[model samples]
Target chain A: MIEVFFQYDFLRYSLFTGLLIGLLAPLIGVFIVVRRLSLMADALSHITLTGIAFSLLLGRHINFFAGMNPVYMGMIFAVSGSVMIEKLRHTYRFYKELAIPIILSAGIGIGVVFISLADGFTTDLFSYLFGSVVAISRTDFIVVLLLTSVVAILLFLFYKELFFLSFDEEQAVISGIPRRSLHLMFIVIVAVVIGLSMQIVGILLVSALMTLPVAAAMRLAGSFKQMFLYAVIIGEVSVLSGLFTAFHMDLAPGGMIVVINVVILLFVLAFTSKK
Target chain B: MQTNNPSHILEMDNVHFSYAHQPVLEDINMKVSPGSFLGLVGPNGSGKSTLMKLLLGLLTADRGDVKLFGEPVKSFKQWSKVGFVSQKANSFNSGFPATVFEVVSMGMYGKVGLFRFLKKHHKQKVREAIAQVGMEEYMYQNIGKLSGGQQQRVFIARALVSEPDLLILDEPTVGVDAQSVTNFYEMLKELNVHKGITLILVTHDIGAMSDYVTDVACLNKCIHFHGNKETFEANREEMMTAMYGHDVSVIEHNHAHDHHDHSHDHDDLAGTRS
Candidate 1:
């Protein structure tokens, strides 16, 4: 496997992206799960799916988009959708969760239109939807690398504020932490994570990559820091093992990765329940 | 208008707030002076939480001026000096995977400022706060594993970690046992007297808190009476009727010597803040 990675650039790129996503997904997932905004990730992933489909449709028609990667459009759409979700949640204050379904439906609605117009899932679209180990371009790797770095840096800078808001929003507000901007920043980060993660985990299974490791970590983690550390470890393990298994079996890495996470979740649940 | 008086920590003058078309607070005027332990008591919908929100700038008042630390709320930037423990403390994500030390350290985050790391002194302050609230033994314990009263104490420690001049607690003893409630009040009293921290406690138990607080305010859409504890105890009936409105059946229990004044007329207590 080590020799193979060294020989083939595609293998190296896929492995590198997989490891980075493994870290970034669970890092953001810890906050999402703690804030009870797990559904928001699902909604944003759907929105990214719409972006991917639309980009694929544009790739066929427009000369400019002909050579463009769908991940860029997916990120743009996901970030905008996250901002829109924040606005809509504020508009319907008492019915905040209503925003999730609204965006999810819009995403699916737009996605269906784009997929139909594109004459169905092309080879390109299928690779994005379910993820392909060999399909990751050098540009996608850089984009993921850059996004992961930005997210990690932002998290480090605002670590205390994020924990404060997630732990007790009212206290955060009273402490004058600029909570609205922080929360908006958080959702945008979640959106970008979902968008960037799709290249490795696929649009359909990105939220699982973002959430499942954290779910498993929560069972025995003693503290927030421990939960964060444990989640990243769990995520890295699943991604590496899933990638190896997918390489051997010629299967979708997305499905393999998510199944690995589900197995870990079940094991943790059973193990913790008995203790 | 901003008051130049250094003693007055909070001032809400003619503050009127409403939710949508329904009025929650009307023509409210109140001031919290420094080093005063104020017990804010009212019926369920009397806007105790709303008033706290206004002071904390969580909700902007539709019409009125709210000044904190002698600065207009819009311009007040010294949040580190004002600690607030909201009603949501008890209901905060119970499964949130954080230790007591982490939670207490969050209090100093504001004072520590942004884009900066907590220094050794900050950790020492967190430890000092944990010790202050007598939760030193549980510093490493997961917050979720603590009992309701113990969790409440950790929250108080979080509030005290910053060493704020004014500590605002909105029903801090909601799920705490009776003995713990007494201890919590005693802690607040000690915080007020020894540390000179101004305290505002919002709770439904007016009679129970009357003996502990230095001042009392009866709130029901408006400030019916705001005076010292002696005046509140002396004019209990009038304040009770002003709070509950028109019909209130006051009964003295067998342990009347304990000053347990029970008012069993809360039927008209909901949605009448307008």
Candidate 2:
């Protein structure tokens, strides 16, 4: 297992990307879960899928797009979707949650149109939908690394403000914590994370990677900080073991990772309920 | 427009606010002096919260000047000098994974500024704030595990942690028990008198808080009465009828018996108006 990294660059890239996603996903997930915005991740990921499909369709016709990574387009779409969600939330102040489903439906609707226009269901699309352990390119690995670093640094700088906002937004606004900018930064980062995680965990399972570990950790941890730590640990373990098992069993890495996450959540629920 | 007086902690002049064209507050003029505990008493839909929101810069007044600490609220940047605790029991998410210590530490976030970590002294201040509210023993305990009154105390401690010149509490004792409510008032009085933190308490039960506040303001779509506690007490009966638009008596109950159903009375009054 140790020498396998020396043999194949794609395997090595997959492992590193999986580990980084493991850390980044749950770190953002903690705040999302605490703020009860878990569905926001799903909406953003669906939008990312729309972006990827559009990019693929363009690549089929244009030489320039053929050379470009679809992840960049996916990120652009996800960020735009996030901005729209924020706008719709303000438009329908009384029904803020309405924004999520509207965006989710738009994403899937446009994504299907793009898929059908591009002649539908290629091996490339299947790999993007369910994730392949051997499909992570060096560029994807580098992009994930850069995104993970940026996210980590931003979180460290704005940890307290983010925590305060997540805990009570009204008080945070009253305290003059620059609510609008902070919220925009948070949602944009979440969008980018979802956009990138699509490479390691498929679009369908991306939200599970972002949410399941946090769900399990929420029941066991006593404080917000503890929950954050426990979630990251759970995420890393699931990602690593799932990738290893998938590599050996010739299974989709995303399916294995999400299954491991569910098993962990069930175990934690059972353990906590017994006490 | 009147020039902002630096001595006043808050000033709202001819402040008019509305929600979707329905007027909530109209021609509200009030000034909160430094080092004065002012009790803002009003009925359920009397715009007390909306007024507070205007002062806090959460909502822009449709027509007037609102200033905080000698600066217009729109341009006011020094938030560390002001603390606020809203109706915590009703609005708070019980399942939020935070300890009393973690929650209190949030108060220092604004003071500590952006891009900076909580240092050793910041931790000491957090612990001191918890101790001040007599919640030191439960500092590490999850906030959800505490009773409603205990949670309220923690929120007050959160406000206190900033050492603000002014602390505004909106209906802080709504769901608290009578005995704990008494202690809460005592703690607030100590903060006002001993610590010299200016206080603005918004409540339906002015009878409970009248003993603690130095001044009283009766608000119902406007400033019905804003004066010292002595003057307000002297005119209590006449003002209550005028402000509430009904003949009502305020029962200053003894805390020992704990028989006063303040919330019940509030609901009855609100039910009548609707």
Candidate 3:
């Protein structure tokens, strides 16, 4: 396995990006789970799918855009979708979560149209939808790296603000924490993570990568710091083990990683129940 | 009554608020003098929470001026001197994985600002706040594992850690047990008296809170009565009339009321107040 990882640059790229996503997803996921906005991630990922489909459709028709990475377009849609979610939630304050389904349906609707117009589902689209280990190119790895750096800096700078908001939103507002700006920044970060992570975890299963580790950590962690530590550890372990299994068995890494996360969540639930 | 006093920490004049054209608060005028414990009692839909939100700048009043620390709320940048604990403080996620210290430290986040880490003094202040609420032993305990009363105390500590001059709590004792509610009131009293912290508490248990607060304001979409607790107790019939919009019987609990007897007293008061 070690020899295979060293022999294949694609394998190295997949493992490296997976490790970073494993760390970054749950780091953001802690806030998502704590704020009860887990489904917002699913909504954003679907929106990314639309952007990918749109980019693919454009790639086939336009010579200038033929070789462009769909991931860039996906990020644009994800970020805009996040802003739209914020706007819709503001517009319909009483039914805030309604923003999720509205975006989700629009994403699916537009994505289907784009896919059909792009001459049906191809292997490239399949890689974007269900994830392919070899689908991650050198540029994709660089994009993930840049995103991971941005996320790290923002998290470091705004850790307390994010934590404060997640723990008690009303208090955060009353304390004059620039709640609107910080909230917008947070969801955008969530959007970016969702967009970049789908390259490895697949659009369908990205939220699991973001949430499952945090869910497990919530059961065992005694403090917020411990929760982060436990979540990242769980995420890394799941991804590494999943990738190893997928490589050995020649299965899809996205499904394998998510299944591992589910097993971990079940194990934590069963074990923690005794306490 | 002391509307012209510059010492008022919180002032709302002719404040009118509504939701979708239905008036929630109408012609409301209120003032909080420094170092006074003001208990705001009102029935459901009486706009107690809305009024607090207006003061906290969480909601914009449809009409009128809201001044905090002598500045209009829009420009009231000295938020470190004001702390708030909502009614849902005790109703937050029970499984939220945060330690008591972490929860308390959140109080300083606003004052500490962004991009900077908490200093040692800030951590010490968090410790002091936890100790102030008598939760030092649970500083490392998960906040979710604590009882509702303890969680309420942690929230109070969170509010106090900032050392705010004006502390606003909205129905803070909703889910707390009877025994702890008494202690909660005592803690508020100590904070008010010793720290000179102006307090505005919104609650439904007027009878229980009436015994602890220095001033009382009875409301039902309007300020029916605003006076000292003694005056409020003396004019119970009129205050009850103002609270419920009709002649209502009010049970005034004597000083000898014990924890077990509170239910009887509360029931009698709830019957009238609601």
The best candidate by lDDT is 2
What are the runs in model 3 whose C-alpha is more than 4 Å off? Answer: B1-6, B245-250, B253-274
lDDT of 2 by residue, A1-275 (tens): 65675589999998899889899999999998987889999999999989999999999999899888887899999999999999999999999999999999999999999999989858878877887788778987887898899999999899999999999999987887989999999999999999878787888899999899999999999999999899999999999988888888889889999999999999999999988
DockQ of candidate model 3: 0.74
Q: After superposition, which runs of candidate 1 have C-alpha atoms over 4 Å from their true positions?
A: B1-5, B245-255, B259-274
lDDT of each: 0.86, 0.88, 0.87
Per-candidate count of clashing residue pairs (backbone under 3 Å) = 0, 0, 0
Write out the backbone clash pairs for model 2: none
- Model 2 local distance difference test score: 0.88
Which segments of candidate 2 are over 4 A away from where they belong?
Answer: A1-6, B1-5, B250-274
Against the native complex, each candidate's DockQ, computed on alpha carbons, is 0.72, 0.75, 0.74
Model 3 C-alpha lDDT per residue in residues A13-125, reported as the tens digit of each score = 98889889999999999999998999999999999999999988898889766798888899899999999999999999999989999999999999999999888767787
Question: TM-score of every model?
Answer: 0.93, 0.93, 0.92
| Shift of residue A192 alpha carbon in model 3, Å | 1.4
- Candidate 3's displacement at residue B250, Å, is 6.3
